[model samples]
Target: MKDRFVANQNAHLEMVLQQMTERLLQATSRLMARQGRPPQCNYEKKQNVWSLATSRRHCVE
Candidate 1:
């Protein structure tokens, strides 16, 4: 019947919309991460010596 066909079409449309929403969320997350600030790299300078630290303890000294 025509009603059944219409219902099927609506179900398909709903599925497509759900998929698009998921993709949009994933893309937004990726874009936000890329545009966000880079991780801090601690560097210390002591008497002509330059040291780079990537961990917490190493950065302390």
Candidate 2:
């Protein structure tokens, strides 16, 4: 049935989104570890959603 098909498709998409989130978390942790300190991160609110970004700070050694 069309309803069942749509439900299955939505479930598949949800699983993919969860997997992507996990990967992003792992990558961010690695970046933080290599930087030796927490990277400067920024947050912005767009509509009902929030966005985050991280970057290394440049400092003279």
Query: Which candidate has the highest TM-score of all?
Result: 2
List runs of model 1 lying over 4 Å from the truth: 37-61
User: What is the per-residue lDDT of model 2 for residues 1-61, given as tens digits with 9 covering 90 to 100?
Assistant: 9998986896687568656765676677678879896634421122113112211111211
lDDT of 1 by residue, 17-60 (tens): 65675566556656666989442331112211321222343446
What TM-score, over all chains together, does every model reach?
0.57, 0.59
TM-score of 1: 0.57
Worst 10 residues of 2 by lDDT: 52-61
RMSD of each: 21.2, 13.8
| lDDT by candidate, in order shown | 0.51, 0.52
